[model samples]
Target chain A: MIPFRFSYHKPSSLSEAFEILSEDGAVPMLGGTDLVVKMRAKRVTPKVVVDLKFIDELHNVSFSEDEGLVIGAAVTMNELIEDFAVVKERFPVFYQAIKKVGAYQTRNRATVAGNIANSSPAADSVPPLLTYNAKVKVVSADGERLVELKDFFTGPGRNVLKPGEIIHSIIVPYESPSIGMYYKISRIKAVDLSTIGVALTIIDPDGKRDIRVALASVAPTPVRAFKAEDYIRDKELSASSVERFAELVQESTSPITDARGSKEYRWEMAKVLPKRILRELGLFEGVA
Target chain B: MTITLNVNGKNVQVDVQPNETLLDVLRNKLYITGPKEGCGNGECGACTILYNGKVVNSCLVLALEADGAEILTIEGLTKDGRLHPIQEAFIEENAFQCGFCTPGFVISTKALLDRNPNPSNEDIIEALAGNLCRCTGYQTILKAVKRAAEKLGVEK
Candidate 1:
């Protein structure tokens, strides 16, 4: 059980939530899968927990061809997967990423916004979101702003969310025809943290090939391999070019040795997984 | 804070501290010990419960968050004191050894069969991934789920 006593506030609106969160020890909570665990471990001791699930606007999942998809903060991974077929069709990488988080039970309560806010380097959703070029809508008492998802993280367990500011929704803009995959290496088949995660999306619009690559648990935070993407943008699909791309992707990561995996193993998989994913997608014309 | 929960088809009101978890309230306050506390950190599914018709680890949910929510524990699976088909199937198929993890597995199986009356092996494996059983090697448990599906299918 949580070791401390704290006031609980369920705000019906963002304004009320902001009003209560303006206080010193107020932290916004949704799903509480991560927050409550932290509270029990004494990692965070807030005086008040502003429940964001009560806000109606935060329960929305609207999609349009023009605006893409806007997922409210309260939307759980299971809810998204069950309710929308468009997410699976349009963002398969994101679908795989969400499906790989925790297990069936935890996904029923774990929210995408919470997943992003918790800001774990090994978070399954962040790499896919990075590949999608998602944006976070940050709402505060003063005003609101949209931050690029790539720029939102400062470090492990840290983000750009300031006091009294809460994430409103995640916006994934519409993309052209693309095929994406999220490949994760974990110790177990289910309910395990990713030892190494790689998300790759190849978008072809008007005969132009655009490759996007992002990885998790390989650095201080989930990051996109911009240099690798640039190198493979116009390169032919050959054994040597794919190997060169993998090398660049490996260079972009600075993994640490931990119980999950050694730094050397993470580096090796960082190179291997991307190539494996590319081959599986039939994007590589190289040997197995 | 005083919160009213619809537990096992009965609306009950109880006072709970904000720090108390749903698992704690269910086992300690309400005397509902069906959901066991194994790992307490959610790694083990021994404390699994159906929260608003969805299977979730009760240890991870705050009591306040479950306010006004519908909860179904293993105790709720019986009707007229007769065991649920899933539970009966477990006994018939010898699905458990110590029976410690049986409640959680039974609850998860109920959830899965509720959604899909006919489930394949992959479906059963996916649904029960959160629940771990060191005994029986899961082969008997898998048979129990299939048998439960057949029983429920006939009843339906």
Candidate 2:
């Protein structure tokens, strides 16, 4: 667990952090849960670690009618799980994915921005956030811009974030007129990547309407199961639809086998999970 | 660099090197030997501590980043020479074999029970997942958690 020597800078304000990020070879650290591990692995040895703990704007979770939910970049996974609004309304799948992130201890320190910024292909939060159509706000020396969450990740452990640009917050639209949930099947319940993760949000309009299903760990990035979703729209939910959608979801993802689980296992579970989630959400009656 | 951490209810300010972790600052400088270093990459929970009342991997956290934050170690579990309910439960349940992991477990359990007094079996397992015990005394550890819950009388 050896990392190269580096300069430490604790910036209390957003402008100070922007100045640091504008410098060459600088990395903005929120919680250091991901950054330190990568540093020890010698994967990313930046010359300076700009700690953003003092930045008040990057450390809050607030609600707004105009913008939806504004989640600070430094908000930990534990905070998301314990947030009353998140647990009750906006999204329950986010909590389900968060619970499997690690142990309770690590979650307390692992920030949501770090989880997304680390850009792991199997990050539990991304898929569900993608399902919700979340937006990321990136701040730099020049200014800030919002990017769609689905377009945030470019590849495994990578994103399109420009040099000297730091993610300040994520904006999730509170369009939760549906029952949304996430399910992941891992080797074990804790500290492991998902073999396949499924997120479903069914918006029932007077028992006759539209639904959306998004899934992850099935492709290079979290993908929306548009084909399967189109199959269930405006149709009465039932066991037959669940089976059909399950079959359709298997065709949606491109899962690979690593140490976590087999590609076949993931493909198989990818089919099973969506239908199970729909059932649990009461969209598909008598299918649990 | 000088860093001030409110450790164990005491405001102790100390200076450390650029490449020092919270674990290094605690054990080496402040002489707060409660947080032991196991796997310094945040996998093992040997260096667990309560930062702002939430359990975190102290080894991964830089000392400079923890300035002005309230930290609680196993030593802080007792007040006026009275053991915390979780600590008493451990003693009553005989929850240790070699005891190297006791302090970390005690602090971790305190964080869990404080937030959720009547955590379910799954909750307990989830809370302790980061901690590892070579003695395999998880049964007694679970018993201690149950005992603490009973002593508190807050079931969920």
Number of the top DockQ candidate: 1
Write one digit per residue (lDDT tens) for candidate 2, span B1-156. 777889888998798776788888899888888888877877778899998888998888887778888999998878899988888899999998888788888888887888888899988888898887778559999999889888877433
lDDT of 2 by residue, A1-288 (tens): 245788889898988888887777789888787888788788898888898867887888887646777789888777766864544465666667777786777788887788888888788887777766789999888888999988888877789799888899988776645566778777776766777778776554455455667676778877778898788776667778778878887888888878888899888888878877766766666544
- Residue A280 lDDT in candidate 2: 72
- Best by TM-score, which number? 1
Q: After superposition, how far is residue B38 of candidate 2 from its true place, in Å?
A: 2.7
| lDDT tens digits, residue span B1-156, model 1 | 899999999999999998899999999999999999887777678899999999999999889888899999999999999999999999999999998898999999999999999999999998998888887899999999999999999998
Q: What are the Cα lDDT values of the candidates? A: 0.91, 0.80
DockQ comparisons of all candidates to the true complex: 0.80, 0.67
* Residue B130 lDDT in candidate 1: 87
Those runs of model 1 whose alpha carbons end farther than 4 Å from true positions after fitting are: A285-288
TM-score, first chain, each model: 0.97, 0.91
Minimum summed lDDT over a 10-residue window in model 2 chain A is located at: A202-211
**TM-score of the B chain in model 1?**
0.98
Residue pairs in steric clash, candidate 1?
Answer: none
